[model samples]
Target: MSDPNTADCDSNLHASYYADGMQQVETELVENEQIAQSTYRLRVAAPTIAARAVPGQFVMIRLAGVNAPLIGRALAIYDIVNNDQGDPTWVDLVYLQKGAFTTPCSQSPVGTPVSLWGPLGNGFDPRPCDRLIMAVGGIGQTPMLLLGREANGAQAFGRPNGWAKDVELIYGARNEGLLAGVDDFRQAGFDVQLCTDDGSAGQQALVPAILEQRLQEIGDTASVRVVTCGPEIMMEKVAECCQKHHVDCQVSMETPMACGIGICFSCVAKVKQADGNWDYKRTCVEGPIFDAGKIDWS
Candidate 1:
């Protein structure tokens, strides 16, 4: 009963939109340092991916010339740096060593060659707003860092003033030891607030609770936008808080993806449509970043 034209439009909108300069390239490992327990900060010389990458997009990585894993693992593009000529030259990946693939990846030598393809998936669209608040938990810090980097660039999101005022980061982790990259965020000029469940860090509370308190303090909820990435329950609670406060919010979902491209539907999330129906969306293409209110958390 759908209009053919409308259906075609929807298909095109949801289809994989590849940016220019996307390609499979052999990236040399520039730095692979253990930042925390079972966590690593990996840097690669991937000019192509870095040049096109935006906040919330991801890259697929695999050992060069190895087929044992068969499929590459998708990782969020953590950060990007440009050279003196303003050409992107480096990309960073901050990941937890949890699985077989990542464990081996953590031990990869600095000079090892790896296959990478990216800047894939839709990224966060930071609209012109008065304030931006990012709430993250544990390894969810990945995409948030890139967002911070963009905000620090001053001209990011085509905004003139940049994210100058009322930009805050509410980061929650299990403990102090697990709080990675706090210094980096602080150095980027964000009003960083740290939370820990064990009371071993800054504030003793969960991220959502902190976010709710911060929103209340802000008072002008209409002028604020909350962007979050973390545990599903935590994000769900964040969505609830945003809804109650009448604030706009976006979420970067974490889902297992076999192929970073849209060819595989392995990474799917239930999204609510305007027609009041729920449909499965490929997180690798249609998202990783989506309007928090549009997701059916149940």
Candidate 2:
């Protein structure tokens, strides 16, 4: 058998090969993410996503229009759940169609084939944690979905008392209409809280406002930790909230990129290394994820 990693091996190979590797040749377009804005949800045909993807991992994509002017765009894997046949896990990539690549890709039919190249970079570290607090804003909620799914899984984050407790996904958007993945999150048994700016949904303010109320309601505990991913400014505010309350927090940061690897300095973000040297780390490789305190987000 030939590896799907290599696109196709033998010129003489049978037509049924690609069909037999249906798991490797399938794709999805504009489902969950699009519900938020002009977003698109893609199911990539990669073993890398199914076999190896962990929480907060990302993938590189090249739509016809994006590469010529800029380069391939990188998007986080929102979720990695099994498709209907249950043989392969379809990766969830949630992206807005504002840019050149995404705008074109969004126009393609649902079954259109697109080139995908991930489960790239180091994902979140595995732990036996039973409680999870996730904060999200704008389209940044994409990565947290995968994180939430892992925590919701029966083995890694299941309750010892046989009842789920303290797994909350707090989101902030413009309105209830702008909220994506509401059902996906709710179906996973996550406590969902939405704060809309227009007072159209859950609460009317920023994510920090709702999160503050949550912490006030639950009080502090060593077992309580936060994982945040969003715009740079929003993440900075979240860091402040965690710091004031002394809750451990990790944040995923976004930077402009032309290459989704370390060779180009485009995706560099400032972080302090072990030796105390302040340096720039590649977001494409070192992380789209990092310790919130490690960087000067200002």
Candidate 3:
């Protein structure tokens, strides 16, 4: 198999290379519907951004012609669809209304104009694996939906065989009300295992516990690759579990950013090196996706 880091580095270069050449565009909002408690699915007709988007990549968006929010919000590209001519027609984003920007952004009516830029950051690359396991918690489930869709579609095209034929998603939330898109994932042919802390959903356990148990069940850890995104603590546990099982893992880190193009240096993460060295990498450009083992959990 090729070096995962090399692939990711190449991806980073590509994002930066393209981003430097593309201009931000004003797009029209098509939908802004609440899917779960305080969470919404925002769809926009952004042909340029949509055309360049890759699953796990994101866009920086703000209401067009408005300066009240002051800065754009970095949102994961939840989904992308193409028109008959093979041109991208729409882009989707899933966000939680938790702050000054997201609150009003979520409340914006359909047909409102917004500015968008990207297809930014390195995305997940699930190569050379016999099974792909996705552990998603809270809003971190956003990127996994697209990844699962891609993996499922690839399997149908005879790209991966055996257990890899179906992507397994271990989704967890605080309660049943916070769980979103259970049916959508199932409909997409992913094997979904829903977990909720309050026992109000499919299983009563934290996501990491379920993942640990599942890893033990599989036993052959060498063939499995784990991908996780959520709160830092939860991802730390997932990383530890994958390390213990000798399985490779990747994690998507979430951080506050004023600029999605890596200029502000506000979204930096400490990365651990092979020889016990550490360095900071910008999440907006170098990642949002990174090797779980290389992350400095401390």
lDDT at residue 150 of model 3 (Cα atoms): 68
Which is the better candidate, 2 or 3, if ranked by lDDT?
A: 3
State the lDDT of candidate 3 residue by residue for 1-298, as single tens digits: 2245543432323223224423487877899999888889999887877765656778889888887887889888887867799677788888988998889988899998999888777777756566789998988888877777766663211133233555899999999988876776787787899999999998999999999999999987788888999989999999999999998899998888788887787887877655576666778877888889888877
What lDDT is reached at residue 171 by model 1? 95
TM-score of 1: 0.91
lDDT of 2 by residue, 123-234 (tens): 5544445467888888878877667766656323112222224578888887777688788888777889888889898878899877777777778545667788877888
Per-candidate TM vs. native? 0.91, 0.81, 0.89
lDDT of 1 by residue, 21-98 (tens): 457888778899998768898999888777677788889988888887668888888778778998778889898899
Sort the predicted structures by lDDT, highest score first. 1, 3, 2
- Cα distance off (Å), candidate 2, residue 70: 5.0
**Per-model C-alpha lDDT, please?**
0.80, 0.66, 0.79
Point out where model 3 deviates above 4 Å: 1-23, 84-86, 154-163
- Deviation in angstroms for 296 in model 3? 0.4
Best by TM-score: 1
Per-residue lDDT value at 179 in model 2: 80
